[model samples]
Each structure stands twice: as C-alpha cells, then as structure tokens.
Target: MKSSPSARSWIAAGVRHELLTRALPALRHDMAAPVSVIRMALLMLKRQVAAPTVDAAACEERVALIDNQVGELVLAIRSLRDWELATTDDGISRSALVGQCVMLMRSAFDLHGVSLEVDAALDPQEDEHRWPAGAALRYLFLGAMGYLHDGADEAGAIRIEADGANAVRLQAVKRDPGTSPSVLDAHRAPRALAIDAVALQSLADDLGYAVTLDGDSVRLVLATGN
Candidate 1:
C-alpha cells in the first residue's frame, strides 16, 4: 500500500469509521464525567435556590459550574466529530492531539482499572513541533492504550510522553507486580474496538515514524529532518 498523502487520508477515514462503529461505547463512556459534573452542579443549584437565605453569589457559582461542564461536554463531543478530517491533517501539535485521544478514552480506561496520563516535555505556548500526518498518531496512542486496558487484570497507568520532535512514548506502568500484553497486542481490543495493525503501521510510515514495543513501552519514533 502506498503511503502517499491521499492514501493516508483514506486510512484516517477508515480509523474514523472504526471509531464511530466500535468505539461508540467508549465515546459514550467518556462523556459521563462531564455529565456527572453537570448533575452535581444542578443539585447544588437546587439546594442553593431552596435555601431559606438565598446566597446570590453561591447560586451564581453553581450556575457557572454547570455551564462550564456543559461546555466541556460540547467540546468532548466535537472532538470526535471533528477528528475524521483532523486526523489526516499534518502539522497538528503533539500535545493537543494526544490530549484529545486521552479525553476520548479516559472513561474506558477507568472502567478497565487503568489510568491514562500524558507528560509532555515542552512549553504549551511555544511547542511548534509536528510530524507528517501527525494527527492520526492519536489513533496509535489510543490503540496502545486499548492494548494496555485489555491486558490489565490489575490497576496500571499508561504514561505517555512527547519528547524530541516526532516521537511519543507510552510506558505501561503496572501499579503492582503484574503482567500486561506487549504494545504490539494493542490491536487485540475486545470487540475489535481498536485500530488494526496494518493501517496503524501505514499511518506510522506515512508520518515517518517507527512503532516499537520494548518491554513495557510503546514508542513512536519519526525520522529526523522530516
């Protein structure tokens, strides 16, 4: 398969289709957090409203809290909706793209007794670092995370790091002494909810990246100088 730009676009569409089909549960799961926050805020608002002495400031605060959570819910949903094209685009920041992937999968991670964390060694304001076909790498990270989630019989964390241009590393840190499937097994998501190996590799190749599984780490390394 050619790793040309058009070909990569088609691959990204395939991933988006798979996510919409297989990752629906996870997508729904991911929204639960913000919804829970809204619910709690509503409860507080009700109490504040019903209180004998209505504290206007407290009532306004609860309303603001609800509004913020609603905004988060909207952004969470739009992330999934926007990602079909976004994933194929180049020059996306490593941190921002990875954060969206984490947002889309965090609830699923919690369900499987795993935590997902991203650690970037770059200034959020100044980091202009990017790789070719950068956005689809979010699919790769999500796939690796799904791999970790599938293998966990105990609690664990997928510590993802973005360092040096064009590379992101996900290290599976088991909280206790336990085993996990290698990063290669990230394709083995139950119900086939993850990105498959062939498309994943093609995306990596188009991005000038190499995906490697070393012990507990899944690293995406891009070629130097573009």
Candidate 2:
C-alpha cells in the first residue's frame, strides 16, 4: 500500500483542483472534500489493521479505486500549476509543445473515464512558433481544456487524437446529449475567457494556430511552417 503522505503529495502537488473540479464531474460524485479527508485517515487505518499486513480482500478494490482517483487528481493539479509557473523565456522551441498539451489533458480525460493517444511527429530540428511570456498561453489552453471535458458523460470514452502534422481532435465516446460544444468553445475563445484571451489570441494568431469546435469535438491546429 502507498503511504498517506505520499498520496497527499500526489493529490495536492500532483493534480490541479481547479481542473478536477471544472473538467470532470462524474468522478466528483464520490469525492467529497471532507470525505477525501476521511479517506486520507483511512490510509493510516490500513497500516494498523495488523495480521492483515495488507488490506482485507474486500477492501483491495476500493483502495485501488481511491489510489487511481487520487493519482488523476494529482496530474490535473500539476498540469495547471506548471502552466502558471512556466515562463516563455524557458527557451524550448515549441513554447507550449503539442506533447505537453496532451500530457496536461490526460488528467481531464481520466476524470471523464476517457483514454488519450498521441502521434506527434514534430521536426526535432524545427523551431517554428515562439510563445510569448506570461499567463496568456497558459490561460488560453486552460480555458479550452475546461470546455473539452465539461459535462461529459460515461457512456464510452473520449479519445483525443493528435496527428504528426499538429492536428488535434477531441471526440467524446458518445455525443454529450447533456451539453453543447458551443458553450465550451465560447469559454475557450477570445471573447469569453475570464483571463486574458485577447493576448492569448494574439499570440496564437502570430503562431498561425486556432482553436475550434464542431459538434461534439474540439480541434486545435498548429502550423509546422509557423
């Protein structure tokens, strides 16, 4: 069994509470804030169960579920946190690389009970788009992500397919009869961002990339020639 402190580190440091709360709602049904506190307490209880050096058979599955839940939470929290702390001067060619975006989106996918696959083939020698320094890049992507998983149901799985040419597509398993892609698009678009969408759009315009939504899918296209 993983220790409680280790799990807490995984929760607070590893995942973004905002993304977890905003992106995925299905997972939150069982995760009450105070209940999470109790679960943390239970981790300690497991160690003292004595004789059962491990957990009881019935508790094994529940423990696994909790661990997975906590892990997903950790990833979501960390992705957004990293974005906030990242500087454009970091000097990496593709400022907000497609791969990094995919990794960041994984937490949201997990929350939606979705799986993600990436097939990026960026030219290693190529340095095309240079992202500007500040909160613009982070917020634009974060806002877009907020919509990607909004109100997504658990009928099937959401698949985010990104090709080598920088074509990113987000498809939920079954159409979210419960929500509209426009709502999410509006949230990610320049006009609707609570943060600085104008600057983000300007940077994206300079990079020759744009975010769009069609029906139940969201697409982000970046240019190799940018």
- TM-score of predicted model 2? 0.37
Model 1: number of clashes? 0
The digit string of per-residue lDDT tens for model 2 on 92-182 reads: 3232454454555665455444455443434334555454432333433544444544534432355555434445565656645665545
Give lDDT tens digits, candidate 1, residues 33-56. Answer: 899999988988898889899999
- What lDDT does model 2 reach? 0.47
Off by over 4 Å in 1: 1-16, 19-78, 86-90, 120-127, 130-134, 151-155, 178-199, 202-209, 222-226
- On lDDT, the leading prediction is 1
Candidate 1 Cα lDDT to native: 0.64
Error of 2 at 87 (Å): 5.3
Candidate 1 displacement at residue 176 in angstroms: 0.9
